[model samples]
Target: MHDHAHGIRQGDNRRLLAVSLAITGVVLVVQVAGAILTGSLALLADAAHMLTDAAALVIALVASAVAARPADDRRTYGYQRAEVLGALVNAVVLIALSVGIVVEAVSRLLAPEPAPVAGGWMLAVAVVGLLANMLAAWLLRHAQKHSMNVRGAYLEVIGDMIGSAAVIVAAIVILLTGWTRVDAIASLLIAVFIVPRAIGLLREVFSVLSESAPAGTAVADIRTHLLRTPGVRDVHDVHVWQLTRGAPVFTAHVVVEQEVLERGSGALLTRMQGCLAEHFDVAHSTFQLEAAGHEEREHH
Candidate 1:
């Protein structure tokens, strides 16, 4: 039943990503042309940023589709981790692109003379690019809340929007002051906007890849809750981690009174699972009911 609902959500996410990709693709071509015509480093940097965003959206789109595949004998968890991997790749690409832009901007700033920039052409193209970015952002806004892959694409679009704005500001400054160096300065600002968000996303990707417990969920708190259940003497080997965003998996060895075992472990198991689902928002859980001192007889 849950699988059916998840499939529906994945379908919606893919549609959103596709539309956003189309918008970005169009803007990317326009920006590239504008950059070449105006010889504005800021416009060129923004175009480069859009190019990567378009690629990232493609990766995210493919990953969203792959994540819908069912588990098989060879891959028990299915392809859900594909989304995480997609996010990882997006973060790495963003960081690398930002660093490259920064390096180029620095070199341009150090050049003997500032590069010529056509402020009028740059401004017109930047305005169009900013509008396209705004549209793409609106399309992905809700979907990003549900999937990390979508979130990565959404962040990239937002960065592109900022880059476009910087380009516009640089264009206006150049037009008023005849200062071409503002173009390089705008590229630096765009790069600055990208690095921190990319690093933050990378941190989240690592957390999921390492199988760390989801934020705000404490293993100790789960242990305490399980121990409070009727007939449960102790809880050990409690493991909690997420397969992906919003999908948490839990496993624990629960020691219960012999009387409860004699009465059948079924009811106790149900109670514990219910407790986890209700309190911890863990829907998929496995508990091994054990007789008192069962762990003592087993080699650790």
Candidate 2:
């Protein structure tokens, strides 16, 4: 048996997340104050969403830092999965915030409350918030591709930006015509964007937690390739799962000829690991090279 991992590292995302965390924390305070002064549901919803963004960035920073630690005997796989856990939490929080905003918006729409909306003030605050969210989004854009933690933070800022835009539009309508219901309408629209992004994040986190195959990985192709390798007569118990985002692990049993096992077994193992690394981008793999009929013995 052998284990092969190409390259796995962490901590690189911490700096980006730290900057984002600071920006979100400051923006959250501003938005909250704006919501209070203007009593705009759209601004309030955007503030609430910003609060989650701050929390997500904080968790992402910590997770990235923890995952950077080297592997030890007590934890051979290291703390790489912490990032996925952080992402999972972020997704849940986003869903809750979205639901809360939607419910509040619906109530306001139906009840038609006399909201004290300061159009000019809310518009100014929202524009500032939008700029801040855009900056944070740009900082996290590149890292979000391979790291779920980064993606979670990126999505939050994007959602916040959308909410801010909706608030801006509402402010314009309120400024031009004395319509307060536009605020509630804008909040409802913001919720619409939030829910879909939250669902996507949830799906990605669940895939990792469930040990599902990583995106784009083809199990059948891998099996066929292994069978074609020299000295490999049979393949069974093959499995593939992601240890974390961008880190795939593979395990399988390969039946070999008796003579091949005795003379050049080590070489075959290297070839199998190499194929997985080069072709499939699989970093870690474990192969149990056995004599023919080993699969039958396992059943008993």
Candidate 3:
């Protein structure tokens, strides 16, 4: 039953990500066309933002497929890290694009250009972009909660949505007040929306790659919990990290109670695994069980 449910979940994720990629691709094209036709800096920035989102969706689809591969001799941990690598790459791309947009917006501000289309028409396209972004966000919402790959894509869609809204507002202001500077301000606002998100995502990606402790799951706190469990004496050489987006893997050297070690080491290990799973949500764990006489204190 569990295996069947797991298979169904995997199928659902693949289908959803594929559909998201298709939608993002179509929206990116439309946004780019709208930008060119309207000659609106705001529209162009939003189009660029959607372009990054489309790229993220494509990377996520490929990364998910790679992550499903079985463990091999060269990679004993399997290909799960592909998802993290995908996120890291996406973050780098976003940073680059954000920098480019900021530079262009600054240049345009110094030397303003007339918008080709009337503000009302540009506003109409911005509305369409906004709707497209919302739809994309909904498609990836569930997956984002569980997977970093989806989260990266979700962030891009969210940033694009904000960019679209900013463009719409700028268009309205341009129409009402004849403020050509509004387009440059909107472009800068789009960069403001993107840069911070890109920086945060890059930090997460590097943390995962560096095997830093998973956020919100402190190593000392986990050790203390394990020590309180039955049959556990001392814990050492402990380490924890995310195996994938949601799954965490842990390893520790555990000194068992003399009686428990004498009776059944295998049973003690099994009990410890259960305890770790129940308390810490650690899905995979490796505990080196040590008997009392053979145990020696070790520091991390």
Candidate 4:
């Protein structure tokens, strides 16, 4: 990996997140105050979603910082998993928030209450929340593609933005049609949007942490590639997994011809590693080379 590209200029994102975090905190406060002042469920729901966005951004900032740490003897793979862990945590929090929203929305639906200040205040707050969510989402967009932590944060903000838009539409409907159930309906819609994103984040993080082979990488293909290499007799015990979001690691036992053993087998292993890295994007690789008959005896 190129030194600059690996650790690159992350400070910009840190600074952006810091600014966005502060703004999000303010938005949460404002939205909550607006909710209480007007007794508006839409405002309250938006406030709760904003709180999630703020927490997600904080986690993303911390995870990105931790992931930038260099590898050490104790942590051979370094701290790249920090982003995955962050995503997992964010997903858990989102699920909890969704549960709370569902409960509140159901209760509100059972006995609908008139939202104070009619529709004007709700619309104003929803508009403000929408703008804030959009700004935060834009700020994190670039970093989101770089790490799972930011991706989780970006999704949260996007969900919040959608929720805000829903609230705005609900307020408009209430203003025109006087249908109060629209607020509860919008809350349910927001819950629907949030749940799948949370589940996806959880699944992706768990897969990476479990050392499951990444999507599109098949063990059979890797084994066949190794077996097809000249002087290689067979390949067995193949293992492939992600070292991080982008770097995949592969390891296998390769049976080689006896003549190749006398002649520098190290070169063969090096060539195999290069091939894996170049074609399969497997950065870290290990290969145990053995003579044909010795392979079965030697626990590959």
Against the true structure, what is every candidate's RMSD? Answer: 2.4, 2.1, 3.1, 3.2
Candidate 1 residue 51 Cα shift, in angstroms, is 1.0
List model 2 lDDT by residue over 1-300, tens digit each. 556453544555788888888998888999999999998999999999999999999899888888787779998888788989999999999989889988999988888455769999899999999999999999888888778888888999999998999999999999999899999999999989999999999998899889999889999999999999988898888889886777888999888999897897788888988898889988689988889887788766
Runs of candidate 3 with Cα error greater than 4 angstroms are 1-10, 112-117, 297-300
As for candidate 1, its clashing pairs are none
Give the per-residue Cα lDDT of candidate 2 at 123.
98
Give the least accurate 10-residue stretch of model 2, judged by summed lDDT. Answer: 2-11
User: lDDT tens digits, residues 45-102, model 4?
Assistant: 7899889889988997898799778889998777888888888889999999988888
Candidate 3 lDDT, 220-264, residue by residue in tens: 888898888788878988988775577677888888878886787
lDDT of 2: 0.88
Better of 3 and 4 by TM-score: 3
Candidate 2: count of backbone clashes, pairs at least 3 residues apart or interchain: 1
Give the lowest summed-lDDT range of ten residues in model 4. 1-10
- The alpha-carbon lDDT assigned to residue 82 of candidate 3 equals 87
Assess candidate 3 and give its lDDT. 0.80
Tell me the TM-score of each prediction against the true structure.
0.92, 0.91, 0.92, 0.86
- Best candidate, lDDT-wise? 1
Report the lDDT tens digits of candidate 1 across residue range 1-300: 122123238899999999999999999999999999999988999999999999999999999999988889998877888998999999999999988999999999999988899999999999999999999999998888778889999999999999999999999999999999999999999999999999988988888889999888989999998888889898888888877776777888888899998989888878877887789888878888889989777535
